[model samples]
Target chain A: MALDQSVSRRRLLQLIGGASVAATAVGTLAACGGGGSGSSSSGGTLKVIGVGDQEAGLRKVLDAYKSSHSGFDFNLSFAPADQVQTALRTQLGGGNAPDVHVVYPGNGSAMSMAQLAKAGLLADLSSQSWTQKIPDGFKGAFQSDGKTYIFSPGSSMLGAIYNKKAFATAGVEPPTTWSELLSVCEKLKAKGIVPIALGAQTPWITQLIPYALVPGTVYAKTPDFDDKMLAGQASFAESGWVDAMNKYLELQKKGFFNDNPNGTTYEQATSMVATGKAAMAVQVSAVLSAFRAASQTPDDLSMFPFPATDVAADNWIPAGVVVGIAVSAKSKKSDQAKSFLDYCGQQENLNTWAEAVSCVPLYGDAKVDPALTLFLPALKANKAVPFMDQRWPNAEVQPTHFAVVQELLGGKTTVDAALKKMDEAYRKKA
Target chain B: MPAVLVYAVVVLYPSIAGAGSAFTDWSGIGNAKTFVGIDNFKQLAHDSQALGALRNTLLLTVAIVVVQNGIGLLLALGVHTGIKSRMALRLVFFAPVVVSPVIVSFLWKFVYNPAPDAGLNAALGAVGLGALRQDWLGNPSLALWSVAFTVIWQCAGYSMVIFLAGLEGVPAELHESAMVDGAGTVARFRHITWPLLAPAVTINVMLSTVGGLTLFTQIIAMTNGGPGYATDTLSTVLYKQAFVFGKFGYSTAVALVLAIFVAAVSFLQIGYLRSRETAA
Candidate 1:
């Protein structure tokens, strides 16, 4: 290395700065001309991405599609739910989005149908044969500007999953009222059993108790709570959410939860209920199989609608699409992708997909799984509401909700103070 | 021209593009971004979670720098003595450094399990010290410290290896003469060895400080910035803001602030330490 004594530090900085400026200019220009999906012009490999078990199920669907559709091949990929959103967004930004990608049914998600459709990243699927099969309520989740942009095969309900054996052992039935729930906790505690296996260490798990309680307390009285929230007429702090938060805190004060819930993971919480150490946990219906797998008698695990109000009829279960799929706007084989989605929408294919993943079928005529029969009464009465977070304005609110609830549970903040913080996050102008 | 183009494309372009977002209301989605002019930074100042993240980042960095370097120096000293098993001990201590931070965090997460009879609590309870067991990663006050301990645990051996290299650079004659002069062990280390180890100290401090400041994977894996915003650092908050919240402009402002802090701190620390380096 030769010494460049003539190059002063100031001059060196200038040179570096100039080089960076020139590089940025070229980089931006190059990014503008970034490659589109090369196979977009005609039949080729249709890249499909899904998260977790959705990917595995989609793989089976794709394998079927490949046999029936001769012109196009399919590439399948999977990521965890959060990472799937990240991967889709990154690819969408780079203009090489997957030909078919898993999307959330509605807004408040990163790859929400509303946002993707707004960005013109999803191909219109309004003309697909499957569009007629979608019921009116689900039509809004997959459509924007009166054009369908995504297809959801099924939905999942969020409720309390309990060990039937433990409940039987304690001589208590599933509680249908808030007071009954408290009494059941007392009975379980008296019997030396943990009433609920809470895993607040996981922020998602921390939000579950509040979510499960919010519908009956808030939505039952005000059915349009989330709509009001989106319209800025209601705030999380003021919309009976405080009552819901109070009920969650009440559970803690009454010592109904497991020891060191904040330290326990979602996996450990599942194990707790699976092994009959704890009686129950507030969880999504999707994880019922995981609980069953962890126990010798998988049949001992069953679910019930978690009641949040004293009036039994006021209780509502939260349910929504687990994941939906969208065709990339820039895809070359978009027709093939739509063809595959159409095949998925057929009653037989829908049943296969739903049964494979243990999700509730979306179509009216589709077969409902026996495992999910517990929620049919609530569903039949039309008492099930969409998840509160599904209609939230943006992703920031749920996380803030998670953190504040965790803090409340950890004794770091009061319910009012935590909800106040959530209000601040929710009110952040987009 | 090619060199300038490469630098512009790879380095200058992204920084400029990223900095541009710090001033606008971009959401990393559509191309439309309205210039907000310092609103993001303004929000950060009042944003309690952002402030908490900044405070936690500083605390984590300070804790990591002091503790990691101290333990590394101690380990180096221990292994440098005429112990026959020094090589094996060195390998054992350095093993964690080779493992990815994500894996290390996962492993330590199991170790810090909050269950009454699982992991750390189980061990604590087994020794008839059950009362000492607490939720390690779930309590707000303890989560930050617990994560910091895990970071230090993973990186201390890295610092030790650097110190050991610096120790080898010290000639035996200097220590022999100092011992011959009847100087105490502490005196010899303080007067002779400590001053000479300045280069290693600077390296270890710089590496640990940078690592601690940019800490993300471990926190995300171990606690995800919970049991309630207690363990969030700047990087994790930035990820959440940009990716989850879709606040690209605001997150860029956060990134810009973090970049400035890290650069200024590293520059100052390295400068001060370099000036302290003794000429052999």
Candidate 2:
């Protein structure tokens, strides 16, 4: 009887195991089936996904396109910046990306035009008429291996977005030099206003201060710094990056930034500056609308280049091509998506989108946002460089830069160790 | 036979195919992969980030298994009595268990806001314990514990329900006889209740252990393993390797190791706990 009971017990165990496995398998299939439903191209509606920052321009253009051309319908959605790196990338990897989706310019991110185009995941946009009109300096951002893959409105200036009211309260104007910036910050602090609102908790936010600084400290001194780094002739630890990082820390030591920056978020910092609790934040012109919306006095805000050196002439700015859209190679409605992109490239639509986002139109001579007047001279003087990560070989360096900056803000790592970590990340295979 | 076929097609095939990627260098996109036998595993062995994540995972598992289950048992015992409000107490305690982990994490994130005038800090000041205020999720040293505390707060109720079921199964006759005799409540619990509760203890321990070892959603939702990777676990590291760093093969290797480790731990724990149950 004991022998019989043991045999039955073994069989019962097998039965339970098989049932559980079957249930799990069915659940997995249901999940996989559900995920593909959103990307389907049925009934001629083009599926579109964009980052939140692109919504103002992207949605306006899409709406205008729909009104002008009947049957050019689109299903538009926006993902937060961080979610795009994961959710959209997963869709791309799974070969179920939307008909049109956001793609960052240049090569330093997983969802960048170069990376996706190299994977044969993005439709070639080289045949579009506007591809030929891309400025010579901005060609590298739009093209990978001589093929255009993404369409962007224009370059966005990275600088300090300040409240005129806050600056006036402290009796200071936007500083034109590093020493002047320090004096202005001291004045702002004396008036009990935070000089700078650094939101290091948001990973992408941590890189802006460095981006605002590196144009002068690294690129201005060595125009071919990216080329030398690519050739293994230069490193972040040995270059002007050290001075930039030291200046960054020097500002912190002087208590210019808001308290516990690593704990603060981008929205919090934006609110601080908008409410005049803080004087300024190093930010991109693309987000000027967000800052304006957060303030009761939207007209009080304007932007100027964040000074990086004591010499006013050395204060170069970062003006990189803004995040843009690409047609997925796997989309069944590629033609429709391409047409929409082409529509976006028309000078009128380009200017409209650029104006909505407060960026410079890519190829047109249009009136730019008035708040960006201070940085245009630098752009005209060729004192501007593309965002540093745009030239990085791989995605790792950008995230490592973000992490090290947070570490620096948290007092968890020194500049030397932080730069060393970045150097190590830079050496990784792309 | 149909179930077996479905299982093979849905579960076995994809799992085995995915496991094969561990020996290659796939970048999680495209057909560009190279066979690089065990290179990922070798790299993982020396990877400081992965090592640190492992340490975090183990620490979290131990803390959850001990503290979560301990509080659960106490709650179970407290609510098992004939108190007039026992059902209401049980319902209140088990409420969080029914809510989604993502929702719980987000709610707790707001509670841990670092500003002195907001969330937990304000509450601390209200209670005259202002000195206890901290940058809860922002401080590297405190982030992991804060995440752990959230997980515990949300899960202790689950353990309580399981222990409550075990408590219901304990024989009331034995307690009654002991009460009539020279036995007190503590003596009866030590002699009769604790030993009989061994099976419930075993189940709670195993479940909490596995859950803690695989803790991902809370940490990701709260910290994204930030403030310099102080809250990262093996799961988040593997996720970042695949999605963020675009190293799919290395991520798969890490996943396979984590799977094998969890399985081995569950097996050993079940074996030891089952024997203890039988001995009890």
Candidate 3:
């Protein structure tokens, strides 16, 4: 007991000492740094750690904000995409999480904003007006109960991004509907070009095909899909999710995708479509910048939301996803953080974000880039959904989805078998 | 014992913590941790995805151990012929072991690409063997073999080195006496050469078995265990659960099973090898 007491006492002292040192370092950084947390009384820095793309945009936005308000400085640090989550967990575990960060809650991803909130790591921004202003449809995807954990600047529309030039040269138009998309794929293939660039080797890339179709399946075939599945009132078989899997299988059968599509990577597909070797690919709007960066000109590529079907009820299904931002609960500068979130809600910053990233702003009158016009119809229709894996019950669903896609492509498991495996996987605790 | 204790804290504790988590319903993180005993493991019993991973892991461990050790022992014997070119050949054979798995994965990924433009497919076509070309990493029938080949390639040399070290330690007088006793090469190898290389066999078998079973980085970088779970292993399953799907408890359970598996196999190998040494 004495040894235990002494050991714990030493640990407590060490923890307290560490905390004091951190507080002092933050103090020193705040004193010298000019990043403003909007409502800062002593003028402190809002340390934001995220991917290079978001960090860069945040820095640009901060630069503009700094032009108007002289006190705020952003002590910006970034990790490449792969390292972000691990870095965040390490920092947060050390009681020094970034004041601002991005959260992606797909399968296997950590630092999910909701998971953070569930852990009491997120600031309670229930009072934030912008959180309330989020569209009702989007609120469920972002907030749990009545509390907001993250603030996403813009939402993404998932679909095929193709080279307009290549399509025109091939004497083909981009697919407007699912059948038409397949038909367009056939035509592209006839021209001795690879049709769809399916990056199946990257499990997540395989996910986009089904993710783009989830809304249609739910909204069209079974309106009660989400509720029924959650309530145990439905299974994957009943929901036409199996039908979606069959369609994926048919694509493999038709040879509409690249040969050994499972061998291609997300980046390789982006390169293929950008270079006009492949006609189309199903990917996220976030990939637009990457596609653009890979392309000769940003205008060379364009997006189209997943093709509409005959079901009228499917009109509400948007092929887009939501990414929100939330403040950390343990932050000392909660008031300042809330004010900054409010600032993000302002039209100026929202517009700036839309312009910089070619993103669809969730609120305010931000203009969509001309290139993203193909997806405007769906976005305006209010049919958007968050990434499907983010909404799944367990982590297994994400990889299960990957496995199913691979099987569907591989000719090993039938659609029914694969979907059965998926539905069963969802019940797993892990 | 203290050093081992430190290792237990650093390593074993996390595993035990994972096992504890498997009993609870911890969704990655949070204070709302719920206790639901045996639920995660129960879930695994019904999980075909986890079952697929288990199958793949077992298949891979078996194949790589048998194939890698077979090749390694063959090469060790083949090259231990006391030739001047042996040094150069050793460098060539062991080269893949030093290259990072990530770089090798990229190289093999290209080789596995089934497209007409792919190097392997193009070469097949050039050789009039187009029909023989397969989507080595994309076809469900082939993905497992594709990854296993890479594992064997990378690890066979390591096994060879272990066997080589063991082979070099064998007394030349024993082999010469066997030869003088009218023993042929095959007879000498069967009794003396094989029996003495037990330590190397144990080490090589254990190392390759673990390497094949755990199976990360290369499989992930090369194939991400796709073509419909054809290449999935326990580590990949554990990863998909904990990190991807936010099922920390269940994923940790998978990890615990893997740990126990590695331990059991190691124990068996060591015990078998020690007995063999005593028998000799």
Winning model by TM-score:
2
Estimate, for each residue in B238-268, the C-alpha lDDT of model 2 and write its tens digit: 9988988888999999999999999999999
Name the docking class for model 3.
acceptable
lDDT of 3 by residue, A101-151 (tens): 666532224566555655677776555556555544445445554555566
Better of 1 and 3 by lDDT: 1
Best lDDT goes to which candidate? 2
Per-residue error (Å), model 2, residue A252: 2.5
Clashing pairs in 2: none
Arrange candidates by DockQ, descending: 1, 2, 3
Question: What digit string (tens of lDDT, one per residue) describes model 1 on residues B1-280?
Answer: 9999999999999889879899998878877789999999998888878898999999999999999999999999999999999999999989999999999999999999988878888999999999999889988889999999999998999999999999999999999998999999999999988988999999999999999999999998899888888999999999888877777889999999999999999999988898889453
State which candidate, 1 or 3, has the greater DockQ: 1
Residue A297 of candidate 1: its Cα lDDT? 87
Off by over 4 Å in 2: A1-43
> Local error of candidate 3 at B56, Å?
1.6
Tell me the lDDT of candidate 1.
0.79
Write down the worst ten-residue block by lDDT for model 1 chain B.
Answer: B271-280
Tens-place lDDT digits, model 1, residues A95-181: 888888988876776678877777778887766666665554555566666677777766777888998888888899988899999
The docking category that best describes candidate 1 is medium
lDDT of 3 by residue, B166-226 (tens): 9998899999999999999999998898889988887787788778778888877776667
Chain A TM-score values for every predicted structure, listed in order = 0.83, 0.90, 0.81
Model 3 chain B weakest 10-residue run by lDDT = B240-249
